[model samples]
Target: MEAYFIGLSFVLAAILYPLFIRMLKIKNIGQYIREEGPDLHNYKTGTPTAGGILFILISVLFGVILKVPLVFLLSLSLFGLIGFMDDVASIYKKDALGLKAWQKFLLQIIFAFGLVSLESTKPIFGVEVSRTLYNIFWIFVIVGASNAVNLTDGLDGLAGWVFITAILPFGFLKQDIFAIIVAAAVLSFLLYNTRPASIFMGDTGSLALGAFLATFAMHYNAEDALVFTSTIFIVETLSVIIQVSSFKLFNKRLFKMSPIHHHFELLGWKEEKIVGIFAGINLLIALTFIVYKMW
Candidate 1:
């Protein structure tokens, strides 16, 4: 029965992306690539943004059909709203910068704090902790994961495939029923989101995947193990932090570009090769986590 939803979502995503592309184009809702990004990506500017809406809608539809808990679906919708607003603002501004960093940060923190207060989220990897500390840590995971994915979205097929590698193993290993369902939908969306992507996932897709993956790991009481599962995201995020600090403190750029993927690209690695390598690294992390759990 669960597998049925997964298969259905995969088919739905495959059907929905092309249709969404046409609709978004008609509506003039498209992505605005950042000026600071690589010259190679300028061509992608104005591609249909909010392609994340495809998977988010699919997830909700399937969640209803599958009778997933209402609270979880609502929570997912809330996070998606935050991303949607950011996407909308960026389009209106005609630039990739949308929702000042502090604004996004505050919203994520509020959402994470509210989520952790839920009865089901009380347990953190089966360990008891003070509520204040737990809120801080959970906020870190939610915000960090969301932004990590946002940063990794610099290249075609990068964030989507990396998320698949990071997410599916834990879902299957832990028998997380909804994770499997969402994964199927995301996989189907990837049909159009790969190289020469017809549509960009934008912040909408990035935040949905990020918040969902972060919460999904917590849903299974495996937050501790998620560090291993999401190593690539963490590394990408850290590269940004390191670069920023270096520039601030010593006036030296740490990498040719931040997020590390851009650094590799600047070094002349093909986009396909970089995505493949990162996907490999993510697979290694997921496999290690699975083996650790089994052992």
Candidate 2:
């Protein structure tokens, strides 16, 4: 029964995505590749962006179709809307840096604060942690996970496949219908999203995925599970943080480029190789986490 929802959403996405592509192309809603990015990616500019709207739509629809809780649907809408705003801004401005950093961060913090407040009274392993601290950690995880995915979107199908590895296990292991729906939908999107890509998910897909992941973690109180399943995202975010801090403090870069994947690209690694390597690592780590959690 659970698998049925996954398969249904997958088929829906696979069938509907080309239409979305044509619609975007007709509207000239294209991605703007960063000028500062790897030289190989320069040619990818102007691919129809916001391909994520397809999966995001289907995922939410499946939730509603299946009569998912109001709380989960609300959370999904909130985060997806935030990503949609950034994606729309990027389209009009033709700038990869959309909605400005501070604005996005503030929005994320506000959302995080609201989410944490819902469970503020829950005991933290028998310890009384301040509500402020709880909200801070949730904000850190939710926003950090959200942006980490944005950074990982450099290569075609990279973030999509990596996200599948992080998402699929939750449904089967935890019986989460929402996870199942999202994972399957993402896989279908990856069919067109693969190397020699047809369309990019842009900030819309990346941010929506991040928000979905963070909300799932909060839903199940599985923050630690997120660290293991989403290790690749964590590493990518850290690379950016380290690079920025290093360059600012010591006038040196921690990597050839931040977000690790670009650093490898600069070192002559192929996009396929980087995506494959990270996907494999993500699967291995997630499996290990599952085994440990079960033990």
Candidate 3:
């Protein structure tokens, strides 16, 4: 039954994406490129934005139909709402950057805190833990991962592929039903989100997906061992952090571009090649994580 649900969610996502594209009247809704971003991306202007909403809606509806816990449903919905707002803001501002830094952080903190409170007060997948520590740990995991994915969304299909990699190990663990459902929903989104994407996940998809993965990882208490499982997202976030810190402290650029993928792109690698190579690497890492953990 669970497997069936997973398969069904993916198929549904594949079908609904194009429909939503039309309904939202989002044709040629290009991303708001940062003035400082790579010169090549200037042409990406007028690509459709807010496509992430389709996947979010699909995932939530599927989860609800499967009767997932209210806590998880609420958490996912709240994060999706935040992403939706950010996406809308970006389109309105005509800037690639959506929410201001502080505004985003504030919202992330609020959602994370709310999710942590819910988890601490309830039994997650039948596992119990200290409420105080659980709440604190969840806040870090949720907010950190949510932003990590948001940062990784610079390239076509990069974040989506990385997310698929991260979710595989969790499915192998089979510790939480919600995790599997989320993973399935994400996979469905990836069908249209791959390289030369028909539609991008945008902030709406990335933020919600990140929050879902983070919350599920903590819920299953997979933190200590899932280090490799989340490597793609972590590396993406770290690359940006390192780049910013180096520039601020020593006026040095760490990578030609931050998030690592853009660095490769800047180095003259084709976008398709970079996506393929990184997706392969992410798969390898995820396989290793699963093998080691299950052994």
Per-model lDDT: 0.83, 0.82, 0.75
The full ranking of all candidates by TM-score, starting with the best, is: 1, 2, 3
Q: Rank the candidates by lDDT, best first.
A: 1, 2, 3
Tens digits of lDDT, candidate 1, 1-295: 7788888889888987888899999999988888888888889887888888888898888888878765457556767888888999999999899899899889988887776666353667677887777777777887788888888888888998888888888787877677788878888877888878888888888886888777776656678767887888889999999999999999999899988999999999999999999999999988987987888
Please tell me which predicted candidate would have the highest lDDT against the true structure.
Answer: 1
Best by TM-score: 1
Worst window of 10 by summed lDDT in candidate 3? 118-127
- List where candidate 1 sits over 4 angstroms from the true fold: 69-71, 120-127
What does candidate 2's lDDT look like per residue over 1-295, in tens digits?
A: 6568888999999999999899989999888887788789988888888888888888888899888755466555666677788888988897876788888888877876666666534434445667766677777877788788888988999999999999877555677878878888889989988988889987778877887787677667777788889999989988988999999999999799877999998999988999999999998999899888788
Which pairs of residues collide in candidate 3? 28-46, 29-47, 30-46, 30-47, 32-96
By TM-score, is 1 or 3 better? 1
Residue by residue across 10-114, what tens digits does model 3's lDDT show?
787777777765655544465677788788877666666667777677667877887876666766788878888888888888887788889888998888888
Per-model tally of clashing residue pairs:
0, 0, 5
Candidate 2 overall lDDT versus native = 0.82
User: Which of the predicted structures, 2 or 3, would earn the higher TM-score when compared with the native?
Assistant: 2
Residue 79 error, candidate 1, Å: 1.6
